[model samples]
Target: MTVTTRLAAAALLLLSLAGCEGMSRGQQRALSGGAIGAAGGAALGALTGGSALTGALLGGAGGAAIGAITR
Candidate 1:
């Protein structure tokens, strides 16, 4: 990927992580999990030539569900 793409992804990840300031523990966990999963999925999708958006959506949903179920 180009430098610009990498930078954009980094910015997006940072922005996602910055939104958990006033949330409950479970809400924070779910948001954190979803952000991490989406970043991972987007990176994998970029490397594998798949749809990053689809991967992000799927990963975010799965992560949120798991986070919600864990405690």
Candidate 2:
């Protein structure tokens, strides 16, 4: 994705997550981890010229698992 597209997506994501105040601790952690992972994965994928969607999926899954397992 282009720089503008990525920035717009990030902004939208942040706005969407702003409503998660009612979620439990674990749920919040998982969501936060997934979002962070997906962003990192997408960046890595883009830098490596791979598939950003696939990277985001895999990363998000891994992150959610880790987050769920934590305190």
Q: Which model scores highest in TM-score? A: 2
User: Which ten-residue region of model 2 has the weakest summed lDDT?
Assistant: 60-69
Q: lDDT of each prediction vs. the true structure?
A: 0.84, 0.88
lDDT of 1 at 36: 85
Model 1 stretches with alpha carbons more than 4 Å out? 1-19
Tell how far residue 12 is off in model 1, in angstroms: 10
Backbone clashes in model 2, listed as residue pairs: none
TM-scores of the candidates in the order shown = 0.66, 0.72
> lDDT of model 1 at residue 50?
98
Count the clashes in each prediction: 0, 0
Q: How does candidate 2 score on lDDT?
A: 0.88
lDDT of 1 by residue, 1-71 (tens): 99999999999989976777779889888877887888888888878999999888888888887777777
Instruction: Report the C-alpha displacement of residue 64, candidate 1, in angstroms.
Output: 1.3
Worst lDDT run of 10 residues, candidate 1, spans: 62-71
